[model samples]
Target chain A: MKNFYKVGLMLTVSALLAGCGNLTNSSLSSHSNGTKTSKVTTTGTSKSGQYSTLLQGGEYHTSAITGLNSESDSDNASNPKSFEAGLLEISKKEFSPDKYFFQEGKMISASQAQKWLGRKSKNNPEGLNPEDNGSTDADKRNPIYLQQLLEQDFYTQNDKNYDLSGMTIGLSMNDVDYYTKEKYGAKFETKISDEQRLSEGREMANEIVNRLRRRSNLKNITITVGLYKQNVNDSLVGGTFFNYGVSSPGQKKVTNWKNISQQNQVLPVVNDEKPINSNDSEDFSNFKNHIQSYFSNLSGVTAQTHYQDGKLKGMAINITTQFYGVAQIDSFTQFVQDAAGKYLPQQPTIEIKIQTVQDPEAILVKDYNTKQYSSHVFASY
Target chain B: MKNFYKVGLMLTVSALLAGCGNLTNSSLSSHSNGTKTSKVTTTGTSKSGQYSTLLQGGEYHTSAITGLNSESDSDNASNPKSFEAGLLEISKKEFSPDKYFFQEGKMISASQAQKWLGRKSKNNPEGLNPEDNGSTDADKRNPIYLQQLLEQDFYTQNDKNYDLSGMTIGLSMNDVDYYTKEKYGAKFETKISDEQRLSEGREMANEIVNRLRRRSNLKNITITVGLYKQNVNDSLVGGTFFNYGVSSPGQKKVTNWKNISQQNQVLPVVNDEKPINSNDSEDFSNFKNHIQSYFSNLSGVTAQTHYQDGKLKGMAINITTQFYGVAQIDSFTQFVQDAAGKYLPQQPTIEIKIQTVQDPEAILVKDYNTKQYSSHVFASY
Candidate 1:
C-alpha cells in the first residue's frame, strides 16, 4: 500500500513538471499499455460523461486531494486489495495565475444578462443564463454560453453603421470566481482593476471596444477606460473598479487590437519584502508624525495625513482664520511648505484649505512629486 | 552540550508556566546556587554598564530574541565561557502588555520640546528630545523622558488662569517604535491594544486624556476621539486617532472627568473567525454580483459597494440620466432598493445618486443599518 501511494505521488509530480501540454491535453488515453488508467484533468466536464474523471469532485478547491480514486470507485469497493487505483489531485488554481479573465469596462447587470438571454431566438424560447436543470454535481459554470450572450447584447446595443463585421465574442466565467475571491461581494465589477493591471486591462478593454465598434453599438461612441484601486483593507472587500468609462459621442472606424492567448504584459509593482519597515518608508512615516506635531504647535490649524507605500502621499491641513491680505496667506503657506520641504527627504504633497471673512474660502495644493503647485482663492462678499 | 540544552529548555518552560511576577521580577538576584546566570530583560537600556548587555545589539526589533552567545570560542579568549553568561532576549513589544499607552493626539513641535526642555530649569538645558550623545548600545528608546517633556510643552501652550495645580503630564516615546515596526518611520502613535489585551485600549486613552486636560491647558478643551480601521491587507495599519479638543470659541471651567485606576469599559468588535469567506459574506458577495447584473439591464446606472464584517454595509448607485420628475427617480431607486431588501439576509444600507438637467445634482442616501434616509437636490439653471 505504501509503495502504491508513492507511485501516485510520482505520477502527480511528473504531470506537474510536464506542465500545460501533456496533463492539460491528455485525458483517458493510455500510456505504454492499453491499460484504462485515469489522469486528474482540469476540465471538469469530460466528454466521456463520467463525473469521477475530475478526481477532486466538481468544486474548484484549494490544495491537493489525497488518496482519491480517479476511476469508478465501484471496482475499488468490491476489491479492497485494489488500493493502487487511487490518484492524487491538484487543483486547477494551483497551476494558474492570480488573474482570471478580462471583465468588461462597463458592468453588465443581472437584468441585462437575463433580458438579452431571454430575447426570443429560434434556438430556444427561455434565454441562455437560466439555471441548470442538471444534477447538483454537474459543472455549473458555463463560460461559453455567457460569452455568446454578452456578445449578442453588445450587438443589440450597437448599430450597423459601426460595423462589427467579423468579431467572435467569448465569455470567461473565471472573473466570477475572481470577483468573489479578490473583491468583497457578489457584485461583478469588471471595470475595477484591483490588481493594478491597468495597461493589460486597457489592452483587454480596447479589444472589446474595438470589436464592438466594428459590430454596431454606438455609431460614434468613444469609450475611455480607467482602473482605480479599491478602498477596503480586506482582499474580499475590494480589489479594483472602473470609474465608468467617459463616452465622447461619435462613431469612428476602429481597428488595430488583437486577442492573444492567456498571456498578459503589464505586471504588479512588486512591493519590497519589508515595505512598511524599509528605511525609505520609515523616514516618510517619521516625517508625517513630525509634520503633524509641528502643525499642532501652530494656532488654528489641523492636519490629517494620507500615506501610501510608507511615503507621505499627501497632507491636508485646515486653517481656521480670516486672512488680512494675500501676503498673509502666502507667508503662512510658504512657511508650512518650507517646513515640509526641509524635513522630508523626498518631495511632499501638501493641500491647504483656508477659511476667512474676506476670502471666505481658498485652497492651495502642492504636489512636490509632480512639481506642480495650484492655488485658488474664492471671491465672495 | 545536548544535555545542557535540554536542561535550558526545561528551565524556560518552568519560567513560562510560572507566569509574570515570578519570571519578570527575578532578574539579577541569584538563583538557587547563585551560579551568576544571565537573564534576558526588556529594558533596551540596561544599567549593567556593558551596554552590550543586550546580545541582540541595538536594533529596535519586534518579538522576542531567541538563542544567544553565538560567537566562536577563538574570538572570546578573554572570557571563553561568556556563553555561560548569556540569555535570550524579548523586546518590549514581545513582552506582555498591560494596556496600550495613550498617544498625545496633538503632536508637539521639535522647537517647543527644545525650548521648554532647554529652559534654564536646572533639570535640562539641551532640551528633552535632543539627539542622543551616549554610545549606540544605550536603550535607543526613552519613553519616560519624552512623556515628561511633553507635559512641560503642553503647559507652555496653554492659558495661565487654569490651575495646573495637581496635574502630572508624561510623554510616552512609545510612538517611535510603533512607527518603525508597524509603519516605516519615527512617528510615534501607540494606541496599540495588543491582541492579548484588546479590552485595555480605551482604558489607557481615558487615563491619558483625563490627566492631560487637568494639566493647565485650556480648562475646557473637549477632545474628540476617533477609532478607525487601518486599511491593510496584512491586517495591521488601522487603529484610532484623536481629533484635537474642540474649544467652542471660549474655555469653560472644567470639572468632573476623572483619572480612573487602569480600568474602563469599551470593547473591540471581535469579528467571527472566518470573516473573509463566511457563508453570509459570500452570499452578500454573490448578491452584489447579481445586483450588478440586474442593474445592467437598466439604462444609465452604476453602483459602488461598501462592506464591513463579512456583510454588506452599503451600496451606492449613480444614475446618469435627466429625470423627467422626482417620481421617475424614486421609482427606479425603489426598484433597486426593493431587490436588495428582498434578497439580503440582513438590512443593507443603500444610497442612490441621480442626475437630471432640471436637478443635475441630487443625492439619495439610505442607511439601512441606522434606518435613516436622506435626499438633496441641487437647483439647476
Candidate 2:
C-alpha cells in the first residue's frame, strides 16, 4: 500500500478552527474627521452552516450560481471574487442566514438587467447609466457610470413553500469608463472623479430602487443596495464598496445612507509616499522580509490587503518560490504560516498562495479570529 | 441613462429550461462482453434544490468547500474539475436531492486521509498505497495506485436535525504512477495496465469499505464508491470514472459492481486512427468549420467532448477570435449559437467559450435537453 505523507493536519485543523463561533459580529471601521465610525454586523461563519433547503427542496442559487461567470466579464480577475464575496458579506447584515435562505435572483430578468446597464434613451427609460455625450476625445468624457448590476434574492420558509422576503442589489460602477472611437480601434478611457462617481451612483441607485418598487410583488419587500466602485481595468487588485443603504418595505427611496470606507490596497506600495494604513503596510513588509529571509531562493512576495475603515480586514498574499519539491513546499508553507502568525494582524483573514512560474504549488489559509492556519500542497505527478 | 443590450434572453430562457425536471432518472450505458448494459439511477439537476438546513444553520460544506483547492494540486488542470464533478454526478444516483442534503465529510479527518494516502507499512497499516519496491530501473517499478480520496456526506432531515444518511467515496487511482528518485530529481512515470489498475482499485475499495464499516457510527450507513482513473500528467483532458458500486445498510462490502464508460476526448482527435465515436467527431469538426467560416479572422477553434458508453454526453468548445468590440462579440456569439444548434448533437450539454488574445470575450451555454442556448458577451468597455 502507498504510504501517507506525514503532516500535522490534526494540529492545523484544531488550530484553524480555534476561536470559532456561529454568527459573529464583523466590525468595519472608518475615520471621519479623525473620529472613528464603525458598523457592526453579524456575518455567518463557516461553523454557523451556509445554506438552507427550500422547504420543497433544490439547490440554493447565488448570482451566477453555475459559477461567478457574470462578474467574469471584467478584465480585472479579482473583481469577481471581491464583488460577489463583498455583496454576500454585506447581505448578511440585512438578511441573516438564520432566518432567510439564499436563492438566485428571480426579480430581475436578464434582459431587464441588460437594459439597465445601457446608456439612457427615451425608448429605454429604465437605463441606469449616463446618456452618451457623443465625445471621441478621451479627455472630454461621457463616462458610463454603471458597468454591471447583480441581484440576489433572500427567501423565508413559510409553512410549506419558501417565499421571497428580501433582496440585495449590487451596482458595479466604473472608476474609468473605457471605450474606443470605432470597432477594434485604439481603446480610450474617461477617468471619473470620485465626487462625480459617487454622486452619480447614488442617483442611479435611487432610480433603480424606485423602478423596482413599481412592481406589485416587490413593492413591499425590503430592498438592500450596495454601491460598488470597480477597480480600473489595469489594476492588479479588485474594487471596493463605498456606500450601502436599505429601504424598508413600502419605502420608495433610500433616504438614509451608510458610508463604507472599504479598500483593497496592494502591499509594498510602489511609489506612494504615504500608504493608506501605515501599520498594515509595515506589518506586511515585515512579514515578507521574514519569509524571504528564511528562504533566499524566494523570487518575490506580494500582497493585496482589504481594509474596512482603517482596520485590516483580509490579506491575500502571493509567494513565488523556486523550490519545486512537495516536501520542500510543505516545509516552506509551514515556515511562512509561522511568520504570518507572528507578523500579521490576527483579526483579519489571511491566505497565502505558493506558486511556481507555471502553476500553484501550495496554499495556506487562516480565517479571521482563528489561531491556526491550514495548508495544502498539490501532489504533482 | 444606459439602455439594456437586447439579445432575446427571454426566448433563450424559456428554451434553455425546456424538459427540465427534478431528480430524474439518468441512465449510464456500457457495452460488456458485446452486450449493452445500462444502469438507471436518479440524478439531481439544477431544479432539484441542492442543500438543506442543518437545523442549527450554517453553510453546507463540500470537500474543499472554500474552492476545489484540494484538487488544484494536480498538474493536469482539468483533473480537479472532472474528479469533483464526476463524483458528485455518481453520488446523485444514490443520494436523491429531495431527501438528502449535502455536507462536507467529517468521518475521514484530514490527518486520517493523509495516513490513508500513504504506502502500507508495519507502523502505518492505514496506508492505502503500495509499498516502495527499491529499484533504479523504471521497468521494474512499484506503482502508486491512489492519487487522492474524496468524501461526500448526504444528510436526511430528521425531525429538527439533519443526520447523515449516506456517504460516497471517490478514489482517484492513477493510470500512470509519477515519482522522482530524489528531492527535486527528474520526474519519472510508471504506466500501469488497465487490467492491473482496475483489479488493484477493486481490492483497495474493498479494504476501504471494510475499514470504514469498522467505525460504529458508519456501520449501518449506506456507502457508495466510484473508482476514477487519473489521466497521465500532461493530459489536456482530465480522468474518468470506470467502475462504481453501492453497499447497502449493514452490508460489509460492495458485492455487485456496475460499469461506467465515461470519457473526455479532445475533439479533432490528435493521433488515434479512428475516433471513439465517429458521429461525434464529425459533428464537432463541422461545428468548428461552420463557426470559423462565419468569422474568417478566428485564430483557432478547439473542443473537449465527454462521452458515456458510445454516445456524446457534453461538449466544451473554445473559440478564439481577434474581435474585441462588445457588439461584435455578441453578434458572433449568436452566430455560433445558431451553428451549434444546426451542427451538434441535441441530447448533450454544450458550452462555447469565445476568447480574445487578452481574455474571454463571450460565453454560450446550452444544457442537456434545452432547445435555446443562453449567451453572454462580456462588456469590455
- In order of listing, the candidates' clash counts read 42, 33
Instruction: Give the TM-score of chain A, superposed on the true chain A, for all candidates in the order listed.
Output: 0.30, 0.80
Across B1-381, the per-residue lDDT of candidate 2 in tens digits comes to: 001100111110111111121112222232223322222111122233333322111112234321222211247767765776677778878987677755546577677777778888888788877766788466796777888888877776444224467988888888877777877787887788889878888888888889888876678788999999888767778899999999888888886779999878777878754677888899889878855644567898888888888777788777888755332344466556656766777788777777777655656666677656655443311
The lDDT values for all models are 0.28, 0.64
Who wins the lDDT comparison?
2
TM-score of model 2, chain A?
Answer: 0.80
Candidate number achieving the greatest DockQ relative to the actual structure: 2
RMSD of each: 28.5, 24.0
Relative to the true structure, candidate 2 reaches a TM of: 0.47
Question: Where does candidate 1 stray beyond 4 Å?
Answer: A1-381, B1-238, B241-273, B276-283, B295-335, B343-363, B367-381
Q: By summed lDDT, which 10 consecutive residues of candidate 2 chain B come out lowest?
A: B1-10
Q: Relative to the unseen true structure, what is the C-alpha lDDT of residue B255 in candidate 1, on a scale of 0 to 100?
A: 26
Which residues of candidate 2, in runs, are more than 4 Å off?
A1-381, B1-46, B49-57, B60-74, B379-381
DockQ, per model, reads 0.01, 0.01
Per residue, candidate 1 scores C-alpha lDDT tens digits across B1-381 of 111100011011111110021222332232222232223222111111111111111111111111111111112121111111110101111111121111111233344444433323346653333343432222443221221122210111011111111111222211122223333443343342333122222333343454334444433333322111122112211111111122221233222322211110011113543433244345445545533443333335444333443355444455555333222233334333333343333455555555543223344445455433333332110
